[model samples]
Target: MKRIVAGGFFLLSGVLLYLGVHLAAAMYLPHITGWSTPPGKYGTALRETGGYAANLFSILLMIGGSLILLIELYFPHAAATYKKALAERNREYEKKHNLRE
Candidate 1:
């Protein structure tokens, strides 16, 4: 129960973090990387403007965290069900073909 709730919270936090990072990136990436000049160089612009590589890294981090949390909570049952179904299908196929394993 606690794990399930924690998973839900992690998912929600990830979504919110992604949204915030997306908004910040949309607002600043153009300014940082839009032109060819010293100030517009990626490193210089990010350093001056207090910007980080938020768009790509934040999204990846959020997705990884959320999936880790949620999958840990839910994937065991799903995996077991899938394994059971596959085993049953293999058994049926073997029976039909008079094959033994």
Candidate 2:
């Protein structure tokens, strides 16, 4: 189960990161990649409209995806340690208050 969940997260984060890069490239370097918007008055060329919004979203996606991937890959033990510490603290608090877990 744990391995399955980790694999799923890895796939999800990879897709998100890929999408961010693809969007950024399409927006800024359409010529190099040969990506462009449809022929219409709204978008005269590549990345002409909603440039700021698209840029912001792409940045967010990249950051979020990378953070998630890093945490899952490098900090799995950190989460276990944190949970143990939290439980210990809770037990101490309960003991001080003369309460049972």
Candidate 3:
């Protein structure tokens, strides 16, 4: 149940993050890419393709998506480690008292 919940949250966060980055690109492109409203004009083509911002964002999204998916693949291992950490902390707390399994 916890794993399921964590995965759902991660998915939601990833989607939202991607959307925000995409929107930023749409706004920042005109400046960073230097695209003109009217094409075929003087200095009409700045990049003639895409800008650094778009490339950077694309790379970032790819890397971030891969990382998130990688982490998700190891969810079971992470959950186990998380449980062990919690157990160790609980042991420290119950040093003065008994804890029920």
Candidate 4:
């Protein structure tokens, strides 16, 4: 449906946004670090010219975004699984509270 497509687009947009940020960072992250300098500060951003931080940031952001998008894609099923687990724990809690095996 339209809603599903819209949601898919949103997830895709996140991926594209991450890539764009990474690409832009690759192009100019050095300037920001240079401006922020004492001399050895922003260590990770220094050695390889900020590529490390940019790549690391990109990877972490990508992973987190992908995980969120994946969960969003499976939202109803994800919610069901969570609810099932919670209900099981609740049942255990109630049984323990009642001192019933």
Candidate 5:
């Protein structure tokens, strides 16, 4: 079950990351095509701002996907460690309260 979930996360993250890269490329397409020059200040500002926004979104998506993949891969061990720590803390709390069972 855990393997399946992790595999799904890996697949989803890979697709998201790929899409982000494609979107980023699209954000730069106009510049690469030598047609980036705008007719007016407003046009230039709009174009630049739009491109930056798109690129920013793409970068965020890529980062989010990568983090998801990493988390999915490491979650099992992390969860186990957290559970152990929680149990230890609970035990300490109970001891302090003189409520051992």
Candidate 6:
């Protein structure tokens, strides 16, 4: 069950990261054209501003998604570390209480 949940998190993180990358690429297309404005033929000032806003949002999405993915990937190691610490604590408690098996 835990494995399944972790797998789901991994899948979701991968999907979000993939989408963020694609969106960032799309947002870059306008800058690459040397147009210095929005890419539409009927582009207006408002449209240009909106385009810039969308690009900013995409960048934010990319950063956030990558961070989340990094956390998801590191979760297992974190869990292991926590478990090791807990076991060590338990051993210390047993030794203090003279309850060692």
Query: In order, how many clashes per candidate?
Result: 0, 0, 0, 0, 0, 0
Better of 4 and 5 by TM-score: 5
Question: The CA-based lDDT of model 6 is what?
Answer: 0.60
lDDT of 2 by residue, 1-101 (tens): 46546655655655665566456546654444343355333233324544545545656655665566667677888988899999999999999998984
Candidate 5, which ten residues in sequence have the lowest lDDT sum? Answer: 33-42
Q: Can you give the TM-score per candidate against the true fold?
A: 0.42, 0.35, 0.35, 0.35, 0.39, 0.47
lDDT of 3 by residue, 15-93 (tens): 6665655555456546553445654322233234334445455556556655666676787799999999999998888
Model 3, position 19, has a per-residue lDDT of 61
State the weakest 10-residue window (summed lDDT) of model 2: 39-48
Winner of 4 and 6 under lDDT: 4
Best by TM-score: 6
What lDDT tens digits, residue by residue, belong to model 1 across residues 42-93? 4454444444555455566567667777787679889999999999999999
Worst 10 residues of 1 by lDDT: 42-51
- The predictions' CA RMSDs to the true structure, in order, are 6.1, 8.5, 10.2, 8.6, 6.9, 7.2
Off by over 4 Å in 1: 30-61, 68-101
Q: 9-96, model 6: which lDDT tens digit per residue?
A: 5556556655654565566555543444444432432244345555456556556655665676788789999999999999999999
The 10-residue segment with the lowest total lDDT in model 3: 40-49
Question: What lDDT score is found at residue 76 in candidate 4?
Answer: 75
List, residue by residue over 10-58, the lDDT tens digit for candidate 4. Answer: 5566567657655655565455544434534344334445455554665
Clashing pairs in 3: none
- The true-versus-predicted C-alpha distance at residue 55 of model 3, in Å, is 10
